[model samples]
Target: MSVTDPEPTVPTRDQVRQAPKVLLHDHLDGGLRPATIIELADEVHHELPAGDAESLGRWFAEAADSGSLVRYLETFDHTVAVMQTGPALTRVARECVEDLVADGVVYAEVRYAPEQHVTQGLTLDEVVAAVQEGFEQATEAAGGRIVVRQLLTAMRHQARSMEIAELSVAWRDRGVAGFDIAGAEAGYPPTRHLDAFEYLQRESSHFTIHAGEAFGLPSIWQAIQWCGADRLGHGVRIVDDITVADDGTVTLGRLAAYVRDMRIPLEMCPASNVQTGAATSIAEHPIGLLTDLRFRVTVNTDNRLMSQTSMTAEMHSLAEAFGYTLTDLRWFTINAMKSAFLPFDERLAIIDEVIKPGYAALAG
Candidate 1:
């Protein structure tokens, strides 16, 4: 008797790379190419921890893997140091688009602090303009293979949230898609930027808050209930509010239930979460539970260079950890596309005509 061959397994790494992706939460400063960083540092006379690209890359990975949010954030200091001029910002932004396109990302929203890049005589508007120029150039260079937008981020500990929020709104028609607050979340909470959040709400602008990663449920509650966040950056800690019993039963607390029921997307970054001590391992990541529970979960590369990852790497790791098929990967992709800050018709077009068809081809 002949036996039917085992059903086709999950797509391979190369196939995953070829699949269309939508990146909702990636950091512009956190994803520069090491070689480019080295060159930029020399131009700006910024001393780097490691002179060579290979060694510098290793240094970032090692420092970020220290399981400390403070330590993980320290790596960005080097990257941001060289990004102080219009030319430097343009170069980084252009290369960011090229890299994402190479990784099969059809659309992405990259965030950075305009305040960080203004030290070298460049105004906040200049910095934003430089980055947008680069994105436009790179998109044209690639023959419009990708669409990249900016999410203006304000450091939570700083006092520029209101200014940055205004900048984001001002540039909304000029390639700026949304606003965000990032930085240490321990003492500095999302509620501290209530004015900015309220302003965005008044202007009817989109904004996400970085919460529930380094902090806990209280942070998540404040972001949603108090601050009215459009999305939760690294909302991995919502898992803490969920309980799994020995009798094979699972339950979610009020906060977690609200997050899931409201369909608020969780920008979960598996590798970066592990590096920041938010998760123990890929197999044990809250994404597994959240996906099983039908939460609005989306995968991302929060800091690609720091985690030594790409969209393909993130998807592949999740697939290996949870035996996810192409369909599963597509589910994550569609979720991200749906949650993007783009217009409804634009998001729907990409999800239907681009993402779904790409995944269908891979599934076959």
Candidate 2:
């Protein structure tokens, strides 16, 4: 009699790397190469906490792991400081695409605040143009093997949401795919940028909000019910609205039920969440529960430099922690591709042509 093969539960690091991935929440500035950061910092005369690339990389990871909110936020100062020039932005953006391609990402949307990069005399339009140039150049270099887009981000604590939202629309036909608002979420809510959200919705634009992360369910509610976000950045706190009893029965609250029912994509960043104390660890991250409950869950690397993570690392760690098979990883890839702000035809093409066949080969 023919015997059945053992279940394929977890994948190896190399197998994870070979799988074509889709990224929806990576930050352009947050994933700069350590050596590139050093060179750019020296050219701009910016003082970094560490002089060497190896030491500087350690400094970023350590600062994020320090458990201090100030230190964690301060880590971006160095990355943002060096990324203030047009060429600097181009180089960083190009390198970001290259890194993602090497990590087996077939599609990605890298985000950055255009206003933040204007300190070095580059206009908002110039910043966007420079980044798009990098993406184009890198995609050309990759020979149509990858597709990358930009998501213009507005700082939540700032008053430029409307401006950033406009920029997103202005560049929509260009390389910009969507808009997002990110920053501290406590007193500053998504409703503060209601005009921006409403404007995007009116223009038939797509956007996501950084919600339910450092804050709680109310932030998520504001982003969804109030601002009508297409997706949730982090959204880890939505788990707070869910309960499990001693008998292993589970119940979802109104907001949680609404989120799952609506199939709102949660751009869950496990490593970055742990670094910011939103998650205790990879194993304890809410992605597992969300995935099990059939929520629209997609894994992402919010800040690769701070977390020292890549798509391969994130997938491999999840597999190690949750015993996720290649089939599970394919679910995440397809989820991200479907949630992408790219045109629906392009999204479908990648899922059917790239993700499905790649996973089938890996599983075989």
What's the lDDT for residue 225 in model 1? Answer: 99
Model 1 TM-score is: 0.97
Off by over 4 Å in 2: 1-7
Over 99-132, each residue of candidate 1 has an lDDT whose tens digit, in order, gives 9999999999999999999888999999999999
Question: What's the distance in Å from true for residue 285, model 1?
Answer: 0.6
TM-score of each: 0.97, 0.98
Residue 56 error, candidate 1, Å: 1.1
Checking candidate 1 for backbone clashes, the offending pairs are none
Clashes of each: 0, 0
Tell me model 1's lDDT, rounded to 2 decimals: 0.92
Model 2, span 13-99: residue lDDT tens: 999999999999999988999999999999989999998999999999999899999999899999999998888988999999999
What are the runs in model 1 whose C-alpha is more than 4 Å off?
1-8, 68-70
The window of 10 residues in a row where model 2 has the poorest summed lDDT is: 1-10
Clash pairs for candidate 2: none
Which stretch of 10 consecutive residues in model 1 shows the poorest summed lDDT? 1-10
Name the best candidate (by TM-score): 2
